[model samples]
Target: MDWRTKLLNPKQKARQDYKSLVTPVYRGSTVVFDEQSLIKDDWKQSENGYSYGLYGTPTALELGARICDIEGAKHTFIVPGGQSAIALVYFAFCKSGSHALVPHSAYGPNKAMAEGLLRDLGIEVESYDPLIGKDIKKLIRKNTSLIWCESPGSVTMEIQDVPAIVKAAHEKGVPVALDNTYAAGVLFDAFKYGVDVSIQALTKYIGGHSDILLGSVSVRDDSVYNVIGSIYMQLGLAVSPDDCSLALRGLQTLAIRLEQLEKATFQIALKLSEIDIIENVYHPALTSCPGHEIWKRDFTGSASVFSFTFAKKISGDQVEKFINSLNIFKIGLSWGGVTSLAVVYPDLVRPNKDFEGRLVRLNIGLEATNDLINDLEIAISKIN
Candidate 1:
């Protein structure tokens, strides 16, 4: 049938003949060609054709192809990390004298990128409320080139109406790029939802071990892929072959890990709601979440990444005490690993003026739910 089917069902003879369980990490700067032939010229001349390791190797190609399948994209470009994927899309589409609409409740760095770097490049970045729905049409201008979105947005976790924004942007000949890292591609199909470009940071759930950092941009059409691919080539953005291998390996177990993590996190979120200390819990699965209706309509699953607001003021020392009291949840950066993590989100001040409270973002890992809950209860009781 198709390549995906073939990959899933390799013959026993093929398996017996193969020497490696994993794809051999193709390591080298330049790919060699036969002597005195046009093949070398093709390698150097064609954009999609391989010339050097940075352009792509077998290892990276395998990962990109797999991600493309999952994203329902015609083509894919692997980058250094999720943030770089976002940056690549911005640089590729946004030029000097252009304008872009960005959701107010975006990842802080994305907003910073638009304001600090894109502004310097003469690109005007305008922030619209994520809850604006179809009203986003009001913010679009004649010069608008891109509409940047993040569902279940950063710390505040506001999920936007993707279809409305996509329809509006496409009507105006603008492209929509979504940061789908939160839902991961398994739960939210970006292409199905009308996103022109979908970005994911493999550093989060894809590379579940947290041992590697990688990112990819999956384009809905060949034309858009060509545009992103051209910019990627021109900028020389690439991921290491080893990192690709790790991410690929992690992909095999992603579904199972996500199920366990979601189950654990949902239970923890329910318990958080019962605690008087927690003011608000921003998990998409929770009914109180701002965009739960949209989430219930569009998404198939949720991740362990959710935030809770505290009712009372607490010092950095008290925050540390709470974190330190946890026996299982480690204080660390990044998530989707086997072990649970808890972080005091002191820097998570929402740009949206309506959101105000001290917060902590928890990434419930593949741990016993009761033990994690008990640890949290003990730690939070100590918070003053």
Candidate 2:
């Protein structure tokens, strides 16, 4: 063979039996086959064997498998990011003329998709109060196909009564899906509560370091798996093998990270609640949160992200100043990373109330507890 032919050869010369404590990043677009008869393309790579990289390389599948093992799911699909995970569930469960119910406090992008893309597609998503647990049945319609619950919802931090909602939806033959990102899948048992579908933005807790963008959609059973899997394949939601590798590493430290984050976050939330200028602290473990009892009953533990509101005396501009005044807490969005962050939601609103820019959300990191508290104290002082 010519020198060019040797250079283009796909066969490996090095031994492939290398073993390590970590999963290696598998990157490739084509999966070569020895026989033409074996050539195929299938998304059920776990059962049917790897046929194409579009479905998932070994690295992506391994991450999905680990999430499934942790979450106790029948199957899990890895998508590009948390929003994609929500999109997958929405597309899978709702179609033209299909009606769905979502909490008013769901992730901002989730609500945007519902009002925008899903609405444009002829699907109607109605928003309901997050606290309307079993009474959710009252809102169910003949066309109601999907119900979404996000415990400790977005910036408002409402811990939903998931079991009650699940029970209600199940009785009416409707499926309940949860944005389980806040609980990081492990802290809360989605399947145990009768949730049909559980999705997470692995970009937050599972990624741990905020360096990767990934998400997972785990189903309670094979029946639900088939429903989500079919749409997952058609959407061509491919993820980077490198990002999967990062998330795989993130899983190793998740338990310890959650432990420290929970402790530090609760401490900070408690301190904030005592301040006269802070009207409320919306941590799930605290009484001030909307569904604290439900959280205690349903969750094994709380996570790092929570929200707080300034007193009426504190203007929206003052809230922004407080966030900017923080030295250690960076001004940013997203949560469950190694760095503490703070951001204000000036335009946040529910049915009867609006934050009026006094609402601020915080993501506590693994920083020293006292240091974080001091940072918040100093910022509050500056605003005062």
Candidate 3:
């Protein structure tokens, strides 16, 4: 019962090789070593070994492993949020005087970063047409360092020809990175289509609960992984073990969730397209969307997120009224959760694109199909 005895507990206490269904949440800054020589001066955030807490804990590594498995990537690294994953790819491979070709329809913040951060750093971040496909080769220069794509591009729902773009980039010795958040790495195959780096906003689909903020970078080649991981470590990007555990749990149900989402979303998109209130629907599987053939050819399935347009004559006030009337679909930013979200982007990225009127994006979640449709119908009726 002495205090000395209590303080003398051995660091290597054996729990008789206990096993559990879930990866253990290891929360600690200091990893104790048995001997001094075991600790190396030059440590790395590697799959085979442990370095420091800022690099990653076992729990985070496990989540990374799960993502890499789904993505068919050779290595995976976790970041604080989805944008960090995007920025990681940029900071990793790009330097002053280099150029990055990004899809015009990519996530809005990514566009902002390209303009603000990358541009200021002397890297020319050019917005390439999402449907450019192999034509991207023409835009590539000797200083080209990266190509970024977002399938069924955020809000607008234009499907990029990822494979063709990848082919073009690789032939020019440039690496390509994609924001796979919409597909959630389930409906689409990034690596199979020759994407160099796959970035997932784990905050959306992977968290599935709208409670966690995390992101992951999955790479097929070790050299690519090393370039990304080294910058990842130097930047001191570390995710909470608790958040990583939540993401891991989200992985367990991702398949079924995606299946239900695809089914419900397609039906809703079909109904929306036919409605008199809608000007156009932008679902990749739907004919109204651009690059439908490319989507059908490369993607394994569809996702719940899509967008639609109202008649150009419709006033902004009317649009606001319709959205405010919705009960089931809440006004929010970000998608891929159990609850549906409705958001409207006033200014289109390329206002000249074949779009008319106000654009509204919908993230169809795990709600009853009839109820969600009814909510939309009632709101549309009010607007009319």
Ranking by TM-score: 2, 3, 1
TM value for model 2: 0.98
In model 2, which regions exceed 4 Å deviation? 10-12
Off by over 4 Å in 3: 1-16, 41-48, 354-357
**lDDT tens digits, residue span 258-346, model 2:** 99999999988998999899999999999999999999998999999999999999998899899889999999988889999999988
Stretches > 4 Å off in candidate 1 = 1-19, 40-49, 313-320, 351-357
Each candidate's lDDT (Cα)? 0.84, 0.94, 0.88
Score every model by TM-score.
0.91, 0.98, 0.95
> What TM value does model 1 have?
0.91
Q: For model 1, name the residue pairs that clash.
A: none
Q: After the best TM-score superposition of candidate 1, give how far the Cα of residue 36 lies from its true spot, in angstroms.
A: 3.6
| TM-score leader | 2
Task: Say which prediction, candidate 2 or candidate 3, comes out ahead on TM-score.
Answer: 2
What would the per-residue lDDT of candidate 3 be over residues 131-183, giving only the tens digit for each residue?
89899999999999999999988888788888889898999999999999988
